[model samples]
Target: MLHLRVIAPAELRNPILNVLQREPGVTHIVLHPNAAVEPAGDEITADIAREAANDVVERLKSLDVQNLGAITLEVLDTVLSSAAYHAEDAADGDAADAVVWDELVARTRDESQLNVTFLLFLCIACLLAAVGVLTDSPVTVVGAMVVGPEFGPLAALAVALVRRRMSLARRASAALLIGFPVAMAVTAGATLGFEALGWVELTSTRELHGVDFIFQVGPFSFVVALLAGAAGMLSLVSAKSAALVGVFISVTTVPAAGFAVVAATMGDWDIAAQSVAQLAVNLVGITIAGVLVLAVYRRLQTAKESGGRRSAGV
Candidate 1:
């Protein structure tokens, strides 16, 4: 369920009331006429069934409530009403499966910010992966994967592509194009700095078989990335954020890219080339999977809507 608070002008209060009155899933309606001092309008509040929220929100938006006044919606944790139950039954689709495109675009736009904190986290994550590769530590590599912020931009790109938002797509692309190079460069610099400080030594060598985890690229790597990409986007869109950590752990982008930079710096071109290939494979797999999964979900949703229309004799 969702609690919606709308502030609209007095002139349109009647139309707004009509929308609420017409929606069977909307209840606990409260009207405060000319109650807003700053906005100088009526304040209306209602509890809308979660399943029916999308339709109700769309109707309200069609009236330009967002632009003229304001519309605030928040999730309702608890609703104890038979009316709410019937309202849920009255809804055309399940809210849990709902994809609010506007909400998604806003979320991705925010996540695509290429700020100093983003770079800082990226560098730290890359450095951790570099160290993990050098020491052949899967745990360290996993830690780097957890810290890396690259998934946000990747997911943003996927969302933009699905929504046909070119500006958002460019923002996500810039983040990735600028982020990876910067992070990889810092990883190399960190290696040099560590060597200078007598922290560890790395030399061009052929005995890097132990770190095969970083350099080994195969079809399975792509398959895992594809699954992780779908899971990551689903977790984000469905508000199941806890599942995101698992997605992070499942992808190889950070570790492979980090290893590529460090290996190249140490003159290990064979290992560097392999790591780069692994990185490329994982990134492409994730992207293609994300877009396809989102598209499929949308198609299924459309089919469900069509079925509902038929059921309603529409």
Candidate 2:
């Protein structure tokens, strides 16, 4: 299903070719010898000739070819048999690489930066939720839920815990810890500013009791968080990323945090405490669920690998 292109030194070419040939999903191997000048002895290139791109990548990693010079295995969806022979041909690079775990981590780290877009998105979401709470509009609340960008780092945290990558875990945790506080502070400032401009009257609403929606944690709150976390993780690993937006909408984190800020601004300490409790409950529940789901996914992958090895008598 995959097309492998190997450009190695005259001596190492045979060994590398033998490895590729033995790989289960790899076929249509093309060898390029005496290709170019380089510091390393050999240059290896591969493309995904099979639909089992993940399997092929894992097999390549098992060969431990990093010490070799500039080994590039570009996983291609379409077969380019003749193109492998044409070393100088230009092609679109995006289609050449498959989505691997490390690449996913790198992409997530890049996307989760505390940039202006992230701040704006969180701020706007919280503001909308505050307005929703004031007007008692469930539609606006759902809008706020969809606008929150809290899932990026949470998903990253889950992946880190599954892989036992402590650095990633710490980074993700720091992002969450800092991001929430920052979002809340901004929301509070905005609330105060609105009050000064006479744009928001906190006392005029009869539905101050409706603020209980933001606070008032219960077993169902934890259940929702747990399910959201599992769905978020699944959305990350599966190709169904569109479903993640819906997952974001289904949770109340942004709305709760925003409501808590509004409660604090109105000098409602009791509601503020309740909102904080709600936030804590959701966060803990999601983290626990995400970790559990990732652990199971990793276990299943490991079991599959072990079974394959046993079948091959390795």
Residues 1-314 of candidate 2: C-alpha lDDT, one tens digit per residue: 23444444566666677666565444455555566576434445555432345554555555554444444544344454664433213221222222346545665676566667777888888888888887778888899999888788777777777778777777777777888888888878877888789886887333566545667788999999999988877776554678788788868888989888887777777777778888888777877887897778657656766877797699
> Best-fitting candidate, measured by lDDT?
1
lDDT of each: 0.85, 0.68
Give lDDT for model 2.
Answer: 0.68
User: Model 2: runs farther than 4 Å from truth?
Assistant: 1-16, 27-55, 62-100, 204-206, 209-211
Model 1 weakest 10-residue run by lDDT: 204-213
TM-score for each predicted model, relative to the true structure: 0.90, 0.78
Lowest-scoring 10 consecutive residues by lDDT in candidate 2? Answer: 87-96
Q: Candidate 2: lDDT of 102?
A: 51
